[model samples]
Target: MVLTNVEEQMSLRLAVEDFLFEESALLDDGRFREWLDLVTEDVRYVIPVQTTRERAHGSAGSTTMAHWDDDYIGLEMRILRLDTEYAWAEDPPSRLRHFVSNVRVRPGSEPDEYEVRSNVMVSRGRGDSRATDLLTAERQDVLRRTDQGFRLARRTVVLDHVVIATHNLAFFF
Candidate 1:
């Protein structure tokens, strides 16, 4: 017999939760390359800028979207750049720990896709700078149960913190 809506949602939620745990584990362990491999080649991974004026209107503006946003090639280039002799972001590198919880899955219009919402707490120590960045957001993902496995077709991370505490936009959430 086939699965019902609740069952399907449960399964998808577990898949995504697994993905999140693995991804966070990789990041925490400093296995960036392994984490990078999880993302789709043509992934639409972006965190748009939010404004205060958008309070009455909304949160984001399309114009503030990253000028040189990443595709697979761009992500790869970033990896290569960081793997070089002179990478400012990672001369010594920072220690990071990501805490994720309260994962909620909302089934989407498409059968293979769902809306995932989660709370995040990212702690990092770079040189003398110590900070525990907190970003509560909902991740809208279009997941596909592909031949390879469940892969994200699209993911938009809508962060609750309009003014970010994180120093760089280098990590994938």
Candidate 2:
């Protein structure tokens, strides 16, 4: 069984859409554990800070002014924080909606992997919270096709808002 370039492209394109939708739903549903399963053990999820310098170009450095640069462990800790006795940030829990679209799959330089990019828009609301529309940035994800399925190895999130005005991020992107 094999596929031509067109078929592969179509399949991967749909897969990316499905993946984004599924992940978004998972986060909205508060299925953190399940979301964790979607990522590889060596996953990297970063939300790099974008300065107010421009309308598009954000900070590239992960350490520059990033509000978050999380690995698996860090992600897990976030979940734990939410479950804490007094996690003020999420005491009432914020409702989030992740809108992902315009996924473009670039030609894979590696035979077993793909370099994918997409645009994300997240809107969140909570009691007494200003209903922050977060730095909906672009993401560059490196997805690897495995025997099981497509697994995320790396994800770099370049936020549109370099300076986050909201509370701490306890949610998964």
Top lDDT model: 2
Q: Could you tell me every candidate's TM-score relative to the true structure? A: 0.80, 0.84
- Predict model 2's lDDT versus the native: 0.77
lDDT of 1 by residue, 67-87 (tens): 235677777787777778867
Over all chains combined, what TM-score does candidate 2 have? 0.84
Compose the digit string of candidate 2's lDDT tens values, residues 1-173: 23468987798789877877887898998888788888888888887765555536653444665667788898888877778777787778788888898898865666877788999887888778556656477889988778877778889887766567666666666
Task: Report the CA-based lDDT of candidate 1 relative to the real structure.
Answer: 0.69
Quote the lDDT for 62 in model 1: 52
Q: In angstroms, what RMSD does candidate 2 have relative to the true structure?
A: 3.3
